[model samples]
Target: MGRWDPDARGRLERAALELFAEQGFADTTVPQITERAGLTTRTFFRYFADKREVLFSGEEELRERFIEIIRTAPADLTPVQLIRHGLEAAAETIFQPLLEYLRTWRAIVGSDGALRERALRKQELTIEAVLTVLRERGTDEPAAEMIAKLSNLVLQTAVGRWVAQPVAERPLVAFVEEVFEQLRSTVAGEPVHR
Candidate 1:
């Protein structure tokens, strides 16, 4: 393969996911992934540290975008509101295009214990990224951390529903908003257990 293969990273990511799904993550190998992607193992290592990293290749970009959008969000919005805005931007730019991938990714990660742990680490990274932006916006440390974590909770809940439905049912942004509202009501002492 040429050294300058375009989108080698994406190809590797797709290949890795396919292999992980077909053979199970524990059974998949770096050489197998590289072979599936039609690239050398050297090219695979250039894009990712390992097979696990392939599933999370988008997180770094998503983190940066979340931080950027949150930082530039309207100054008057509360930290939670800012987070919602950031998540809205993410839904439009990040999650929307990858809804199907999100479902598959969730299943792949959930199916493996190690992957689930790594996925939690990714979630922590996302929370830290959000807190960074919120703190830069002058939110108190506790408030920033709380808002960031809460925002992630709402996002997680909403995304679960979002990917299960047909895209035509509702946009991810709308699902996020509805989930946040439900979260607010539940936290306000509304009987949510029923």
Candidate 2:
């Protein structure tokens, strides 16, 4: 590869995901990923701290996006509305375009215990960030905490359904909206529909 390869990070990520799927995450190495990507080991390290980082490289950015959504939301919106707005935005901007990649990534992460633990920790940190931002925006602590946790559940459920569908005809935002409706119905003591 040249010194200035285009999309080196993307190439590295695709290569790593392919390797992880074929050989298992534990058996894949930096050299193998670099080799598959036609990149140097130095290039791999420049993009990711380790193989695990490949799957989680966008976590901090995602968390920041959520915080920004909460911080800039209109004051009149309820906590649940704020979470729904943020999740829908995320689905449209982040998850929708990466549907196929995420399908593979989720499978690889689900197969490994360590990766699942790391994913949970990252999720907790994201929820904490959302809670802090909500409180800073004048929401009470209890409501902010509940909203933050509920946001995580909503996002996870939406992504799970979006990825698991046999035909992804609807966008991920649709799934987010569906989940929020289900949440609202359940809280209202109405029959929750699939």
Candidate 3:
């Protein structure tokens, strides 16, 4: 079978989630994932470069998906608004199915020291993705990077709440917009321009 089979990848993902929740990311090994997936080591290597990657391959897809999506966003959408759409698109593409894994994934990384460091590295790559998209749109490099990073923070916060919140009435994109408004109010009330 090819390395990129969605079913195979899903199996690996499920296996990794189980293992991570049980033993934590640091203790989880590729062989463990392969064994749990009932696949050979060769298969695991085919789908992911390493064990840590099972947690993160979605971020790579998120980068590509967000760039393609934000490019076509309506011109009248404010930058944050456009980014909210991009985040929601990426989330729907990547997260809705993985909600089952979210708790396990968080448990593995939540309090572990090494997993936290690795998660930060993954976040840096995500930020770079945002900057790349902003630059490609011909936004001033600094300002684009600034706005992209801000949007990233907004998305991060929004997603954290959306996933954790018991409230089911609002969509994630709507929550992102709500947080942005909250941030705007905070900014507008600041004592002085920094």
Candidate 4:
């Protein structure tokens, strides 16, 4: 056990992201992160297993929250509607206040192969969590898998566009809803895209 600082973990994550963006992930180190965070290396380790974990933290919490949201959603929602509601819940919970972090994270994670792999693994885990929720709702087989994949795509596309596009006055959830609606329309044969 190490020192307990209420803000230590967030500070370490902020410091790590800043360092990773400035010096590149391959060149940044734990000491540098701790130093920048104004915390001891032991404090950093108390919060994160390693420097890489800094970039990948919160994933478990996010997954748990997302699954819980799905599980508690209204029982009458269609499978697609359930996924959409899950996306909306995620938007409210995970992606809303993370805009700046999303930008920095895109740069850092996109620039590093290892980080990208970790991100993909996180996606896989999220999909699995969604699948578990869908299965518990009595969804089965290819339908559940397909809905899970589609939901992931909607999430990825929304987040990607949200981060890659310019800063806008609109909320992130609005963008997610817009993208999801467009996807739904496209799938319905109305083709929002030309």
Q: Lowest summed lDDT over 10 consecutive residues: which window, candidate 4?
A: 185-194
**Model 2 stretches with alpha carbons more than 4 Å out:** 191-194
Question: Tens-digit lDDT track for model 2 on 1-194?
Answer: 76798799999999999999998999999999999999899988888899999999987987787678778888888888888888888888777888998889899999999999999999999889988898888999889999999999999999999999988898999999999988888899996456
Model 1 lDDT tens row, 83-157: 788788878887888877888888889899898998889989989888877788889999888999988898888
Highest lDDT scorer:
2
Q: Where is model 1 more than 4 Å wrong at Cα?
A: 166-168
Candidate 4 residue lDDT tens string, 11-76: 999999999999999999999999998889888877889899998888798789888999999988
RMSD of 1: 1.7
Q: Per-candidate TM vs. native?
A: 0.92, 0.92, 0.80, 0.90
* Model 3 alpha-carbon drift over 4 Å, by segment: 1-6, 76-78, 88-97, 166-170, 190-194
C-alpha local distance difference test of each model:
0.85, 0.89, 0.73, 0.86
Each candidate's number of clashing pairs is 0, 0, 0, 0
TM-score of 3: 0.80
lDDT computed for candidate 2 = 0.89
What's the distance in Å from true for residue 142, model 2?
0.5
